[model samples]
Target: MIEPTHYLSSTVKGLKPSGIRKFFDLAASMEGVISLGVGEPDFVTPWNVREASILSLEQGYTSYTANAGLLELRKEISYYLQEKTNVSYSPSEELLVTVGASQALDLALRAIVNPGDEVIVIEPSFVSYSSLISLAGGVPVSVQTSGEMEFKLQPSDLEKAITDKTKAVILCSPNNPTGTLLNKEDLEKIAAIIEKYDLLVISDEIYAELTYDDVYTSFVSIDGMVERTILVSGFSKGFAMTGWRLGYVAAQPEFLSAMLKIHQYTMMCAPSMAQYAAIEAIKNGKEDVLHMKKSYRQRRNLFVNALTEMGLTCHVPGGAFYAFPSIKETNLSSEEFAEKLLMEERVAVVPGSVFGESGEGYIRCSYASSLEQLQESLRRMQRFVQKQKAGV
Candidate 1:
């Protein structure tokens, strides 16, 4: 008898499942669990955007779009980048629409990471970067960021981490979990490092449109970065179209050519109607992003202020819809902190340790739910903290 061992792909075995999923599963089983775990908008797809998809279906536009995606969608992305971020790309030669930023992440890493290559990941980040890099046969080197610096990844931190084996540095701005952003000077410093090391840069700008203080700028907007950076962005966070499954990559034509090979072979094209709807989303649905951003900022301010008032240290996030508060005062590990919060408060949040070792003393709470929900969660959290203090 031949034995079939559980020979998982070496590329995938090191990857951890998403940190956002476990609590979500637990929430699924429990009754009356208020989840602040997942990072998706509570808003519905804009009606006008939906109408375009509805029209596309009515007009029999249901079929396999070009493997790279629809010309119109790519072109819209190209235009949006130029108008919004000052980054330009030729849709014909240098763009690929993917099935959300997740696939784009997978395709980008797989396309460039040779075995043993290193991809620098700033820690306390979204979980997918390292995992996808691992599955692409790349080693992940994590650089820890401090809450004292508002979780900003500094220039010296980046410089200290680079080595001969380093192939690329992945960046998530208005970052997940912490919501920290790289200002222009911060971005320029990283760009200079990339220029010096001749390393690839992949900028995850999925949260670009949700910026609070100023308009979001692509790292490619920095001098000398446009040619080396691969900009990965999508409609999920900005357009409230997470379920629609659409994202895109804009990079130098040579790299785009290579990435499309993986995308064309693995996922033929993004959803057909989604491509059409996204065109409307790019052209007219920007208002939806503005509305959502305004709401998220309010929730962020309320939660941040409330948590700080409750004696928990929360870094004021500039963008993204999460607040990563330190759990050190609770005298519990991050996982223990989260479990206790769920059991004691009926509020669900993810442990930061699930992101990486650097996240051990924090928990990520997404404010993407609602004002009322956020207020109630904060109330329960304050009560829980008081109980802990009293118990101490």
Candidate 2:
């Protein structure tokens, strides 16, 4: 019999499945498991947004949207970005809607990366960056950010990591896994480095609207940065619309045109009803986002305090909905800590090591669940930690 692997594309074959999903899968199979693993909002899409989608369907709007998505939706996105981030993009030429931020990310990488080109990835980030780069025929250079600097990417380290082959840098602020947001000061330093090196930037700002404390800043808002940055954002995290499968990219017309070509050939367009509903989301979803953010803030406090009281060192996350606590005190690897917690106490979390080697010794606990669920998970985790310390 012919081997199944023989027919697989070398790039696709080399890619590892997402580490975040592995623990989620395990938790799904187990009875009475409380999962803090997946970074998804627990809130349902706001009724108005859902109603708008339903209304669209009732009005016989099931046909495929334009290749660039609905003109009205794109215009709403353009207006929102300009008003919120101080960045402008022509809806007609500079914006392209995608299936999700995932597709926008893929499109951005594919449009810019060439074989052997290097893309700098800040580590302890979303798990897909390196794999996506590899699939685009680009090399991903990992730049590790540590707890010492609040997990913000250091300009000095980033400058040292760049080489002649480097083509682009991927940045996620209000970052996943770590929940650290880069401040304007830190971003200014990074902007200097990118400008000095003339590197393209793919700024993943999906969590921009989920920030807890400080005002969120977009990369394109910095001086001279808009010309070089491709901004990828969406309604998934902010609007509690993950299932809607809608996101978009904003860039200069020349760059967006290239991504549009790829999107037209592959995805063609995002879902029609989702696009219509997204217009409603962009226009009227502020209160819903604020309500969700308030809830997440309470949950973040609940989890972080619980972790600290249990003898784990946790940095208070500034934004997003995750609490990454060090598990080194338990004398187990991140995987060991997570697995034993799941088996013994029925709580699930993603091992930090899977995010990147620098993330090793910590486990990411999402606060996207409710307060009661978070409290229960914390109770189970506390018991698990005590048992580990007792050498059981």
Candidate 3:
């Protein structure tokens, strides 16, 4: 008999499916489920950005763009980075518009990794980092972060993870699941370690614009590190354009060239209409982004306060939309509690173990849903916790 598994790449055979998708699938089958499992903004693409896409279609601008993406969009992305983060790039040589930050992360790994090279990932992180590193033939070295430090990376942890085989370290600030952010000082300390070891960095800053703390800092903002960092971000979170499938990579000329080749062979280009819409959004969508961020700030406070008041140990994340609360006090591992909550209370949230082992006693709740839904979720959660305590 013919077998598909025999034909699959060794890397494909070794990888597990994403953890985030498990709860998403569960929520789909449950009636009356209020889910905080999704990480994307609930907002739709802004009207002007949608209109721009429509106009592109009407004008018959449906042809494929340059292998790198639209020239105009690349220029706009370059300007946007500088204006927002004080990071400069040459549109022609330093930027490549890929499908999303997801793709850019993959491309960076593929471009730089040789088999058996090490890619350092700080956990609990977005699941894709480990999978992508594996797919690119690199070994993922997980350096665990803790809830004690609000899940932020410490200099000692970074120091312990590096060796001669280390090629790149993945850094996600305004991080997924935990929402812990790395401020300038945090970046500086980490950057110093990377510089000392002569290692490169693949920074995922997709949530940069959503930060509620002081201004977001790009790796490019720090001295000398920009030359060795592949800056990955997308319009999905900030502009509520998750479905648009547009994101970019900004890197040194040599690395950008290698990523472009892989992107060309694999994707050719991003969608034409998306490129046009993105150009308009970058040039004039500041108000739209700001309006969304302001709303998220309010939701953050509501969810965090409710969780702590209910006696679950929680942290106030500096950025991103998630509230990570420790579930140990409930005497339940994260998965067991999450499963029970869904079956009983019908509220859907991701178990911390889905991210990595370090996340065993926690669960990630996204505030991206409406306030009404969040309020009701809290009431249900309170009941759920109380019942668990009473041996119900």
Please give the CA lDDT of all the candidate structures. Answer: 0.89, 0.93, 0.92
Q: Candidate 1 residues 1-392, lDDT tens each?
A: 75444666655555667768988898878887889999889999999999999999999999999999999888888898889877678999988999999888888898899999999999887888888888788899999988888888888989999999999999999898789978888898888889998999999999998889855667999998888888898999999999999999988988889999888778888999999999999999867788888899988889999999998899889898989999888788999889998987899999999887878989999999878898899999999988887774
lDDT of 3 at 49: 96
Model 2 regions lying over 4 Å from their true place: none
lDDT of 3 by residue, 123-219 (tens): 9999899999988889999999999989989999889988899998999988997999888899999989989999999999999999996678877
lDDT: the better of candidates 2 and 3: 2
Worst 10 residues of 2 by lDDT: 145-154
Q: List where candidate 1 sits over 4 angstroms from the true fold.
A: 1-5
Using lDDT as the measure, the top candidate is 2
Q: Per-residue lDDT for 142 in model 3?
A: 94
Clashing pairs in 3: none
Model 3 quality (TM-score): 0.99
User: What's the best-to-worst order under lDDT?
Assistant: 2, 3, 1
Clashing pairs in 2: none
Candidate 1's TM-score reads 0.97
